[model samples]
Target: MEQAQMPGCYRHPGVETGVRCTRCERPICHACMVDAAVGFQCPECVRDGSGTGHSRTANQPRTIAGGRITAGHPHLVTQVLIGLNLLIFLLGRLNPALIDETVLIGFAFDPDLGRVVGVADGEWYRLVTSMFLHQEVWHIAGNMLLLWLLGGTLEEELGRVRYLTLYLLSGLAGSAFTYLIAAENQGSLGASGAIYGLLGATVVLVRRLNRDMRPIMALVVINLVITFAWDGIAWEAHIGGLIAGVILAYAMVNGPRERRALLQGAACALVLGLTLATVVLRTAALT
Candidate 1:
């Protein structure tokens, strides 16, 4: 009787092998084999079986972690933003005299002053810095609470760079709108506008995922009511930030999966460019 020829490994045809992939039952050499829960599997089987037990959807945003955001991981960007706001607020409290002449003058969004003093006069920084300033205890507390709630989710989904970009651009949007609508010499300060942007982003993100929007809508509506009902609130800023957030989020959600980073960056640049143009035109009109 002649001896039978043994089957060779699928990946290495030249080598004969008795070992087989547990998942695909194909002959596999040690080099092509991957460890599985129950037994060994081929590379192709291992690749196909990844995340087979999880419940993630196709529409869900991908992150650096290769998994959904969990409570175990800390939202570092959100925490840093909150800390910066608190630190500024504390500094303002420590030196009460700095509120007007120093802090607000140097950082708060003052369209009238910006128009007159101009960027050469150091008012340009206010567009970015104003988002970190808070005067009253309630103001800082409320903004921080909202930032914690919304920022964590947005940061987790969008990642740090995108989250920070959305925030700063949102602030600039708010300031631009305030400059266009606010009375001359009126100074505004707070992270409320950026926080509102986060809310709008949340709405767009939820809608993209085909999830319920009522809860998020309710939050927005309530905030809008408060914005209009309260005295001295910059409803213009809130509205501007919300609109920017919606547009930015839409761009992000609709972007191609393979070119997401490029698309997102382009969207942010468009928004920033439009905002800058508006400011320039408004300032020219004032001049």
Candidate 2:
């Protein structure tokens, strides 16, 4: 009698193989083989045995909408903001003249000029530009550190566009508050207002997630104390930013899920409108 040749792998008909699946006794190619404790098995056998106690299946992590969560990474927007701030600071250092002529007079929030000379006279941009300006090394260092910490978390949760919007709005709110209350001829410039806004946003987001808010609350209290204790600190800006952040976060989190985007946009627009109105009223009072 003639000896029979070993059958070819089912997955690869052209090639001949001696390998046999332990479970199904089917010939398997290297590509189709699944390693088992006892022996190699064919893909079909492995799939068939997947329901057994020894078999395991991996589950993808999901979010609110049954969508799978993507891999986590550092927040880009936060990093970019930090870089821009540092670059501006370095440039100001190189040209001290820039601080007086460009940063302070033209960009830093000057309540007296903003109210008296008006925005068209080069005071309007200060509300926004002030956020990226810092007078001292320690000032930028502290603000940047806080921003790196809190901003990353906010950006991850709220996404780039929303986080950026919140940050600028909060900063503007801080400037507006300062304009309304600060002494005439007093000028403010720093990222402190925006950093405070991040802290407030973190608190609101934590509350929304039903997580403990004690640690964050403690931080807020401590920072507020520091703000008051230190001379030349813009406590008003801190308070204003915090209030604006809380309101904005609350509006975003509590809005209807079906129309969340729309609601958030409306809420932000409303806050901005109120800020503009406050500026108008304050300027009018001065005039």
Model 2, which residues run further than 4 Å from truth?
Answer: 1-73, 102-120
Task: Write down the TM-score for model 2.
Answer: 0.70
- What RMSD, rounded to one decimal, does every model reach? 12.6, 15.8
Q: lDDT by residue for model 1 over 1-287, one digit each (tens)?
A: 99997787775465577888775689975445555555666655554544333212212323421123333454888888888889888988897544454322212344533443433244566666677888898988988898898888777656677788888888788877777677545677788778888989989877765567799999999999999999988888899899888888777765555576677778898889988887776666655
> Model 1, 251: alpha-carbon shift in Å?
1.5
Whole-model Cα lDDT per candidate?
0.70, 0.71
The local lDDT score (0 to 100) that residue 67 gets in candidate 1 is: 24
Question: Candidate 2: lDDT of 98?
Answer: 51
